[model samples]
Target chain A: MVYAYLSILGMALILGVMGHRHTEVNHATVLHRAWRQLAPLLIRLPIALIAASFVGELIPQALFGEWLGERSGLSGVVLASVLGGILPGGPTVTFPLILVLERAGVGIPQLIALLTGWSCFAVHRVLAYELPTLGWSFVWRRWLVSMILGPLSGALAIAWL
Target chain B: MTVFFLLLGAAAGALLAERQGLEAVTGALLSAGELIALVIPLVIIAIVMAAYAQALLPREIVERWLGRDAGWRGLFIAIGAGAVTPGGPFMAFPLVVGLRAVGASLPICITYLTAWSVLGIQRILIWELPFFGVDFVVLRLVISLPLPLIAGITAQWLGEPGRH
Candidate 1:
């Protein structure tokens, strides 16, 4: 967590320098663009955090503790991967939900699997973006290759650790 | 739309906490405050990093290094560049298509997309670190390091229709 904060500070410093340079060249266009993107995150994230906190409080931790724990093992990985692919929304929603699960005792392997699945094989991204832009063939080929990635990663983590 | 749902969930959460009792309310608020504190700065920095990354790479450079015959060197280059390139599918997919048109191989293309998805530096610094912490992030990255290259090799061996 300290590393995260320090890294952010470092990035902010770089952004400051970069933003100033870009301002001289582009008259603050890039700065404005970055802010336009960040504004939504600033507003939505706090609300999501609040909801996620309550969700942590409300959901019985025993449920996740069992379902996503080491006891669940390979099956847990499969389930987490499948869940990750189906999860809706962007980072705000996904991260907070992950937070809830993590606090509720979902292990690192399962979380890793979840994130892998979300990134590599989320059906939403395929349908909404990849299919339309990259076409069916590219999507199909990639999707086929990706089907095992999440579970594979999870299993690997388990074996390695 | 997501924001709308978040608002609704927040409202429901607050109400549910109220019903649960003062202790629940206090607990939720404290945790939420802590998370918000942790997340906000990270989000701000991440947004800036994404913008910077978007500006850093030139399309020409990406195209030159990721061509069909570039081999393992091409694969490594694709992974590094893809990991750092910011924005969503809107930016990435089109860039991949453009690269493919200019003689980038199917395997390299697959490698690029997979690397971007799995190891996206911007997303990790912003979301994963803040939410999952450094430990989980590090482990995931370590385990994931081999995947894009593996996928690329697999694609090469398969030699599908899109092959050059």
Candidate 2:
């Protein structure tokens, strides 16, 4: 969290100087776009966070430990990978919920799997963006190869880390 | 819509907590508030920074490096460009198309996409770091860094369509 804040502050400072030098930077437009993006996030994030919090409270720690914890092994990675694909929303929505799960007892390997799945094979992203822009062939090819990433990485993390 | 579902989820959560006890509801709200506080400012700065970062990398220059004859160099270049190519799929996918039009090979393009998805600098700086903190983000990046290149190499080895 400290790193996140400090980095943002540094970026902001650097961007300010870059904008000053580049006549085309257009700070006003960037700020407007950022604010516009924030509007939707503001509504959705609060709701999701609250819901996730309550769900976290409801789920027994033992249940999460049993399913997604260290001892759950490869199956946990597989489950996390699958769930990562199904979860709605982009990073904003998924990451917060991952935090909830992490607090609830999910292991690092499973978390790695979950994040990889979401990043590589997010069904919604493929449908909405990749399909329209790159066509079905590209999507399928990418999907076939990319599917191995999450589980493979998760397994490696478990074995090595 | 996603909004409707989220609203429903929040409502259900609130109701369940209320039924369990007012204390549960209070706890949920407090937790949510704390998370929101952590996320909002980071998101704003991250998004803004990403916008700036994207602007710094000229599209034409990036595309030029992905030419068909670039070979392994092209693949490596694609991975590097993809990592820094800010914004969401909306921006990145089209950029891939642009690279293809300019004569980038299939393996290179696939590598680019994989890199963008797995090690995207913008996404990591903005979303991952803020949410998961430095240790998790760094570990994930270390593990993920070579993925796109590996995918590209594998695709090339198999003679996947467009590699030629």
Candidate 3:
């Protein structure tokens, strides 16, 4: 965690210097834009985290293991992808749940599929952000092209590992 | 959205409290605090970096490279940019809108989004590496590497049938 923070901070410092040198936008404007973006996320961060914790606790580890364990095979991967797409919230919520699921004996392939599904077919993100901003045409096009990614990747993981 | 999360949290907390005790709720809060402490700094820096990158990026260059005529090169550029670009949908989607306005092709845009979603370096570094460890991350990355290109080619085929 510390390493991640330091590396990203270093990147930010470099980008800041570059932006100052090249962009017409001044430091004040860049900071203002970042602040505008960060404020709302900061507000929601704790609430989401708390919710994730409680929700994680509610999901029994054994139950998760039974359904998504290594022996569960292709059906487990498919189920995981469907659950991943519908899983609410963002990384804050999803990653922690993943940790829990991992501890519960879920297989590597299933987890990979779950993560892919969450990233690609995130129903919440699509409805709340993509549909409104990019419109249905773009959404449908992207969906048509990438819909199989989750399961396909999961199957690949299974084959490779 | 915050409100919805809040209600969900409260409801979940209440259920846990009933099953376990108030201690369960308090434990959840404490753990949440720890997670926030670890992640907040990373998120803040990532957002700042994204903002600066947005400001510094040469719009004309991006447009020229990602335009309709750029073909395979455009797809590659989109994938690279998407992998490096940080933040959530708010940042990515707006950038896509801007790029599209400047003649970035649909296929390139799709590729960019797919790369961003599946292979964002920042996300892998901060979230996946920490949570899933090295082996899992490496395996997932290797297996999923070709996804954006595949999606991009499919989009190209569907969006421009005559050209293909």
Candidate 4:
């Protein structure tokens, strides 16, 4: 957490001190963009937390442990990997979700799925980021691939690991 | 208003204990607010940051490093970056997608995220080791290595279509 901040600070310092002379607006724009960068995170983080909290409460620890738990073997592995493909967003959300899901007795396989899905498939992200630039086809193709990969990879992780 | 209604529902649910309906309303309200506040914005910031990174970084640089020619170095570098790269892959992935637009390959992106989740430098250095133990950390690292590779290799193989 600190490193994330420090790195940002460091980057800012380098940009500010050495590169400031390039153009006044460039310097200002970097900072503006930085704020623009953070604006969305600040706005949405609270909501993800609240949902995760309830999800934690609703999902019975014992049941998740059984069906998708680490000890459940191949089926669990498949379930976990596929599940990973579905969820998407920041480490902030993903990490907490994983912790909550684990608290609910989610197995390693499922945990794997959650993490994988959060980062890899990122359905919402594709729409927000990639679709505009890469086109809808790239977004759909990747999502399609992720849907397949999430479960299969989890299974492989289970088998190989 | 929804929060108020939900809170009222929670109070009602608490009173009867049998009123799962009220509890449902409360939970729904909580989830709705959260979905709007957290999930929505998080995705948006992730996308914007991704856009900025895309705009800032060169496509050729990414391709040269993580492209097929990158070989083992790219793989290990990716794994290392994934492990240490802060933020969730969701946010990180936009950057990846941005990079992809700039010409990063499937494998590199996959490996980057696979490593992000599995290796997770932030989790390992900051939380897991402190909470679990060195043994646990080592076990996790040992276990995680193959997982991302499998994900990367397979995603690259199946999803990318035009590649060998």
Candidate 5:
């Protein structure tokens, strides 16, 4: 990370010295850009939680916990992936869910797949931005790759670990 | 449209989860809870990040590295770049779209977006290791190692727009 930062610094210096007046350049613009980028998530996450909390309050928590936990078979793996797509949250959000899934008997392999899906694809993203910008072809390309790789990764891990 | 589908899908998953077992229900709720838990923190982070993204990392930087001239090196760059590139991985979709609009290749864009979320530096160092342990994290990194390559190659192999 430090190396990356240094590299960025070096690049900035070079850009500065070369005296290339990039009218495109504005330090303030980037800061604002980052915020503009993240604003939706700020709203979306909490709403998702309120809905989820309802499920937590009403749903049969302990019963399903046993089912999804390690004891589950291949079904667990498939279930894990599907569930992953449903929950869209950050790392702090993902970890606790993983722990809970483990306690609920979600197999390790399936858990990995869930994380893979969580990490890779958000259905919301595909619609909100991916398809329009990158094209369905590009979007689908990773989805197909992930479908194969994600499960394979989990399967391999469970086998060895 | 996508949000509609996600909500619909979640609802369906909920039904299926309900039927699966007691455990599935709990797992689902936990999934839901994670989202709820993230509200405050992710929002704060998002606000800060959005502001930052607006200021730093010009459109040209994204275009230059992930652009037409980028070639194969761009593939690898896409993966590592994901972590550093700001936004919720989902939210980053828009930025990726913007990049493509500016001329990033489809393959590089796809791979980069995936790498952004899966291998993001923040998630890797801050969240994943602490939660899953070093071994699990190592395994994850190892597994994720080749993903961008696969995604990029797949996109490239499939050919350009209008081919399909």
Candidate 6:
């Protein structure tokens, strides 16, 4: 956690300096924008963390392992992909839940599938953002082309790793 | 959504308390508190960094590069832009709309969205690297590297027959 914090802080400082040099906006503007973005996330974060904890307690580790462990194979990957696609909210919610799943014994391959599915088949993102802006035809085209990626990556991971 | 999550947490806490006693609920709360304490600082830094990066990025150049038709080169440009573009769907989807309005092809747009979704550097640096660690990030990147290109190519092929 400390490593993550310090490295990111370093990057933030560099970016901050660069922005100050290049952009017309001052540090105050940048800080204000960040705070605006952070506000909703701040609300969501604690709730997500608390929910993840309680839900993690509810999930039986043995059952989760049986369903999505290293030995669970293709079925596990597919199942994980579906779950990932259905996962609601942003990284704040998703990552914590993923951490919980990781601790509960989901295999690396399944995790890959899960993350890929979340990225490619983000149903909420599609409905709320993509569909309205890009239209139905474009969304369908993108979905058709990208749908196989998650399972394909997972299968490769299962084979190689 | 916050309300939904809060209700869910409350229900789960109730169930846990009922089944395993108040001690288990307290334990869960403590665990949640510990995780929050560990992660909140990182989240704050990440948001601020993202804001700065977003401000510094050259938006006009991105739109100009994406609006051109350079075939494979255009696809690569799309990939690069998508990976670097920050914020969420609100940011990305509107950018795609703008690019499309300026004559970007469907395949390039698809590729850009795919890259943004799977390989975004912002998400990797802020979320994945911190939560999953370096090895997992690297492994996932290696395995998923071909996805945006594949999506682009497939979209191009599908569109080829319909081109007038």
**DockQ for the candidates, in order:** 0.57, 0.59, 0.62, 0.20, 0.23, 0.67
Local error of candidate 4 at A66, Å? 2.9
lDDT of each: 0.81, 0.80, 0.81, 0.55, 0.59, 0.85
Candidate 3 C-alpha lDDT tens digits along B69-110? 767888899998888776678768877777777677788888
Candidate 5, A51-153: lDDT as tens digits: 4343344446666755555656556666676778667645544564465455444566677778887776677656766666666767666676666556655
The parts of candidate 3 lying over 4 Å away from their true place are A23-25, A88-105, A132-135, B94-105, B125-136, B161-164
Report the lDDT tens digits of candidate 1 across residue range A1-161.
99988986787677667655763434255567678889987778888888888877887888888999767899999999999988876777788888888888988889889988888886767788777767877777787788788999999999978
The TM-scores, one per candidate, come to 0.91, 0.92, 0.86, 0.55, 0.62, 0.94
lDDT of 6 by residue, A1-161 (tens): 56677788898999988887884857888899889988987888889889988988988999999999988999999998888988877787788899889988999999999999898988888889887777777878888887788888899788778
Which candidate, 3 or 5, would have the higher lDDT against the true structure? 3
In DockQ terms, which candidate is top?
6
Among incorrect, acceptable, medium and high, the docking class of model 5 is incorrect
Worst 10 residues of 5 chain A by lDDT: A1-10
Writing each residue's lDDT as its tens digit, candidate 3 over A85-125 gives 78876776678677767766799999999999899887878
Q: Fraction of true contacts kept, per model?
A: 0.56, 0.56, 0.81, 0.05, 0.32, 0.78
Least lDDT summed over 10 consecutive residues: which range in candidate 6 chain A?
A: A17-26
**Residue-level lDDT tens digits of model 1 in B1-164:** 55665776667677766779768877787989988997897788777666665665557778877865888899999899889778877778878878878788778988999999999888888888888788888889999998898888878765654522
**What's the TM for model 4?**
0.55
How far does residue B136 in candidate 1 sit from its true spot (Å)? Answer: 1.8
What would the TM-score be for candidate 3 when compared with the true structure? 0.86
Pairs of residues at least 3 apart in sequence or in different chains that clash in candidate 3: none
Over A125-146, each residue of candidate 4 has an lDDT whose tens digit, in order, gives 5566556655654555455545
RMSD of each: 2.6, 2.3, 3.2, 7.7, 8.0, 2.2
